[model samples]
Target: MTAAEDVTVVPANEASWDDVAAVFGTTDYPGRCQCQRFKVAGWIWRDSTQEQRTAMLRAQTACGEPGAATSGLVAYVGGEPAGWVAVEPRIAYPKLRGTRVPWTGRSEDKDDDGVWAVTCFAVRKGFRGRGLTYPLARATIGFARERGARALEAYPMITQPGKEITWGELHVGARQVFADAGFEEVGHPTPRRVLMRIELSIVD
Candidate 1:
């Protein structure tokens, strides 16, 4: 287990919107994105205001609503919301369907509901670089398996020394992050982006 595995991670529906907002802060990429990059389609996302995006995220997360279905997972450290990961059925992300990232070299069914994707991750501003994403990524394995996902996939940045990628571009994660979480690199869609996957059915 990674050092940050001790952090407690929970379903977004069980967390409060305030805590979720805290993780996204009020500035930086995560703040503006609200993790909706892959959720909404092109024109809808481009035309929607920040407030509309925020509302869409809140509804997707269903935060603070007990028994509601949530779209992601939230992490807490010392009882403070510290990180988040968007792991849901592949079909849930409308934008992902039309993107070249996942379709560049494979014949994957864009509508496969059994395949889940770890599309985004955000660590609280003050809580970043603390390995919070390690646990967040690991948690996705079980989160997806329990939800009946046959496999979990992520398109992550392959970090190289002296080569810097903006955090906004690395939201999916780094190559090692998913590797540590037991994902194997299956393809390199681009120089920085690599396709990683864990087969839940075989792992059992």
Candidate 2:
């Protein structure tokens, strides 16, 4: 296990595809989800082989390929990929269409490409509760903003006392992570989930 102090968060494009796979392949929580939940739609993902999913993730995130910029972010805990966060223009995720979390109580255009969304998170088993998500979320803001995202949104869950949610359930992320990154709650589409947003101005 890598020490927390040695952890570094880098763009997914900078790391090898294998490093990102290490995080997803560490366990078979659901057999190669590969953080492809939002990237693919419905049963099509179900039929895709692990290798297929892996290749899609690699292409989508552009891992280890400097020239390609359309991908997510990966967190390396002392040279080992320990976590991942999916941050991309809202339009990139077809599965989000008509989803209650992104639409309820909001009157925004569904096809806006300038609006980025933080769709999911993956923290490797041993790196689960070592304060990884927050940093990943923070780094995501910079990643999107630099790419000219006018606003970024995330659907994160609210945590409460006496309520213990498993990592699988909290894969979207925790509300506090967004709050700390200066995102304001735009709406609570679900009782446990909040749609948060942060506006960015290129002129600033």
Candidate 3:
């Protein structure tokens, strides 16, 4: 069992791009999608090539440049890259603005830069089921709050006990993970997905 103390979370810009790639290995949907599902303006599978998506991820992460803007956080277990979570201003995800899930029951400004969103989470193969995302999710609260985000939100899929969910389906994260991180459910747009958020007090 991987203890909570074994994990260290850092902004993507502070990590190496190679470490980030290692977390999103080659065989899984994470590798192909490269966390670009909601990043692209159109349908990801049809509009972007794998190479294009990979390039986009690398550029967005700005890995190795601490002074640059980053789109997410990377987690290391015992100094090995083990997980990643994409959190950025909601407007940064053009495709998500068009999706009905976030807009279903709430009247939110689609272009609110103060409102940040946690879009995806990818855990390395060997690190799966170790509860690494809990800390990663918790880290985003401070990461976003310090950066001026008035709120941090996540659209997570609901998971039930004994009902196995594929990694692909849980990439956005399981509802409980965010809930454990102090996020409150603000919207239930679909039967299987709930929008979770934590209203943060922006730091000066």
Candidate 4:
């Protein structure tokens, strides 16, 4: 297990834009993604330029400006930004439209913004495998629960022992982290990805 003290997870709204940027780094991979995969879809996704995507991230994550909050939480290790987790109401992510997992085995009002969702996670180069995801996941619950979220959901990958999966595959996060955070598996649209959810009232 990684030392819990090594990192600090704060609501994105509370973190400075520069700090969040550091966690995401100045690289093309993260720069291009702009944490907007779920915010855009199909033709628009293909046509949208990086600049447009970046702006979308700025608007959604609420970076830089005071009172502006990212849709996720930023993680810092000993004061250095180390990671991020993108979470918000399901409606905030446009790409989720018509997604199979969220619709399978469950009937939910798709328009309900009270239902928050955990979509993505990013741990900086050296911060991986330090149990950062779990704390981030735990912190998300606190963040959402305090904000009056009725429920929170996550889509995570199921990794098997000795099976090496690429970082991209685990970007949504691992199942163990959600389980540790008290989210129960409610649906499985894909063998590798399971839909996990926890009602805020059940936390206690």
Candidate that scores best on lDDT: 3
Tens-digit lDDT track for model 2 on 98-200?
A: 5789999777999999999998888877787788888888888888988989999999999998998977778889999889878899898888999999887
Top-scoring candidate (TM-score): 3
Candidate 1: clashing pairs of residues: none
Which sequence of candidate numbers ranks them by lDDT, best first? 3, 1, 4, 2
Selected candidate, larger TM-score, 1 vs 4: 1
Better of 1 and 4 by lDDT: 1
> Number of clashing residue pairs in every model?
0, 1, 0, 2
Q: Rate the local accuracy (lDDT) of all candidates.
A: 0.89, 0.82, 0.92, 0.82
- lDDT for model 2: 0.82
What TM-score, to 2 decimals, does candidate 3 have?
0.96
Q: Considering TM-score, which of the candidate structures 2 and 3 is the better prediction for this target?
A: 3
Distance from true location, Cα of 105 in model 2, Å: 1.4
As a whole number from 0 to 100, the lDDT of residue 173 in candidate 1 is: 96
Q: Candidate 3 lDDT, tens digit per residue, 1-204?
A: 579888899999999999999999988889989999997656555488888889999999999999999999999999999999999999999888778999998889998999999999999999999999899999999999879999989999999999999999999999999999999999999999999988897323
> lDDT for model 3, on a 0 to 1 scale?
0.92
